[model samples]
Target: MAPTNLELVTLGHRIRHERVARGWTLDELGAQVGVAGSQLSLIENGKREPKLSLVQAIAHATGLEVTDLLAAEPPNRRAALEIELERAQASPVFRSLGIPPVKVTKGMPDETIESILGLHRELDRREREAIATPEEARRANTELRLRMRERDNYLPEIEKLAEKQLAAAGHVSGALTHRTVSIMAERLGFELLYVNDLPRSARSVTDLENGRIYLPPASIPGGHGLRSMALQAMAHRLLGHQRPTSYADFLQQRLEINYFAACCLIPETNGVAFLQQAKKDRNLAVEDFRDAFGVTHEAAAMRMTNLMTQHLGIRLHFLRVDGSGAISRVYENDDLPLPMDVTGAVDGQIACRKWSARAAFSEQNRTTEHYQYTDTPAGTFWCATQTGTTADGEFSISVGVPFDDARWFRGRETTKRAVSSCPDEACCRRAPSELTSRWEGKAWPSARVHMQMFTPLPRGNFPGVDDSEVYAFLERHA
Candidate 1:
């Protein structure tokens, strides 16, 4: 006789089947359900019984009703076949062909069917490795680049058409979000795929297969903008020329557009206004900027850095310091005379000394520490520090402003304390032979650079900081 818990095993198998039908592997299913794949395997293989909660979790992850999952037996042969057919129809072959298999069956020759089957087998063999290896995907991205280039030549015509249509409609006042752009694309009989929050500067790409457009958000100014523009150019190619038959075919059209829309809508010149507002507000940090402008932290930082460098003529250096006093510096500033080269600096030697003095003074006087430290020649300096932890270990981010004494402000410090000893002591002292002679100068061109310091804080919580406050502060100061 079968085990008494045969029903449970059957249910687990059914759940697994449904997940696989959706093109999800067991590990992916387990992750969605907050369980280990090994545990899920045990449950499916009848070695262990899943809890009630696990059953619900599986159902949720698979998008199946609990009742459907707990049914007495596997789906009927017809139902099973239907599921397989759906999966096959959703395959890349069908997508590239720009038609449904049922439709393809009516017109396709036997040779086409065989070729498609061969392609499917090849894709299956490559699927796991393709996903695992970014280098492979990047190499494959060459095709996308070629496709994007082809589309770019025809962008002006597409943009003209879109602009004309929008102008004729006389509707351009409301904010342009991803949903709005998608609706517009749809009105033009184009499908839409949004990537990375659909930044305002996102450019549209045309899908020749489904006659749709894709829009991905632009996060930075220069390279990001160009990429978005390329995407828009690609969209133009799709809308203006190519035709797509199926949804997957549409996705296959490799159009590249970066942040062209953002540049058009939010010009870099406006950055000064944003920065001025941020400076006054004291509350305007990365997250608030992200939410308000719908951008990422890295993007916002780059934008702010650009504005500071370009308009204000301020030099900004970003430093990553490990607990063991290893420092990596990235400098950005067009106007400043400081070398923008990225190099390792002695961690805790300069910045930490300033911090130690500030911390000691703060503790002794029972007063918050805020002062200027101008020892180097590039100019007076302003600095702020924040502590963060990544998979590698704890780090301190020190952002310095060149030639500005008042740039540093006292914010809430981080709760996590740094380790007592520096981790990179040997390397820190191991000055390169080339630099040994140069290091002797009291105020060499490079040594004259000044940097301010801000104490480290937790990653997300930058103590007593808020977006509104930052905006207000910048506005008041401006």
Candidate 2:
């Protein structure tokens, strides 16, 4: 590959240093190399690219071999630092900050310069490696989903482990309470504190040295949300997980931790028994499960999918969507061809407007559940969806199954129907020509505008540190 601009600049610096060491004036060097002094000056300043002949002529005059003059080596290890310093010193921001850039002679030993710049280079490399584009983020999530599908999204080992913990604490099947949470934490020698002083960005923080676990009253509100956060922290203490090495492993470990918490919230044996009875009665509903277990609707729906697919021998799909029609989470153990980009189903991609999940957002009553029968390119599916209010706005959770498998769900009797030729350009995404013509000049509704796109925020094991905040801390210490 051709040399980069920075490499060329370094070469120029090296050439200038060589001439200075030899005490050769620009005119004197130009006379020996048969090139004009102005041209030679330009070459030394990296203002002009020299031909091979010109370079060879200069090499001979400087008492260096042609190959040595054009060697691939950079002039110094701190080349990048110097370049950046020069650019920053010339910028308005540097003066605004009242911090002038440091100036060092080019004659500084390369070894000493390298030692100073090594940490900066390492931090730069880490930041570059960590900035994932949307496609890369989706690919990582897709790999985890495939792994879940490989095992049918069921981790019996985790469930069994959770059950043992429950049995050892003498905590029989019942709604999880604060006392239950305290018992588990005390057994692990962790002090639990609930207070309103924690920051909004934090949900919880564990201080291993002080033996305290802090939960923010503002973030975790109450009820199931509080229980889930407490149990999640408990799982972290009980489960011995190695420090995550990559983002993928981090996500997988988190999913495992979440599953352990869910098992605690709703005991496996009792949950399975309830599901079996519901399946027999042909009235399985997520809302009823939520009422029975004292969990949120989304929690109940997700747990039902896990239990049904893992224990009941039923295949299903689950989706969580935001108010803007973007799918936040999706899991499928069926033949449905979910809408996807090059990576997979992830946040930011708009769901087809005709689908039940997207249509759930338009309902007048956000608290009420909606059900629909829809035919897609993959097959027919019956879906139940409900919208819940959130700090950011509203989000919908949906549980769907193949038409043949719908008999076991409560909304099987619904007659509302729609056809989705989703992911196709000629399908529902296109506006009807007649209606468009009618409103083209008569009405001018403003188009929806997104303030920002979804980017995966870095989350620490401690709730106190959010995504970019960790990077900022690293910068300060580095």
Q: Compute the lDDT for candidate 1.
A: 0.45
In the order shown, the candidates' Cα RMSDs to the true structure are 22.9, 11.4
Per-residue lDDT over 1-478 for candidate 2, one digit per residue giving the tens place of the 0 to 100 score:
7665555666676777678779988888888888888888887766688888988887877788977777756455465556544444445534565765555576877665555456445644454345444455567788888888778778888899888877777788767777887788888888778765554465665667667777756443446776677778778767777766456666767798889889888888989999999999998888888888788888888887678877898888888888888888888888666777766645567777777888887788766679999888998999999888778987889998999989998989998888888788656666789887877778878987665545354533431256464344324433
TM-score of each: 0.31, 0.69
| Model 2: CA > 4 A from native | 1-134, 218-222, 364-367, 438-448, 454-478
Model 2 TM-score, all chains together? 0.69
Model 1: how large is the Cα RMSD against the reference? 22.9
Q: lDDT tens string, model 1, 57-134? A: 888877778888878766655333333443456677557768746533325465655565566666654442223232
lDDT, candidate 1, at 358: 27
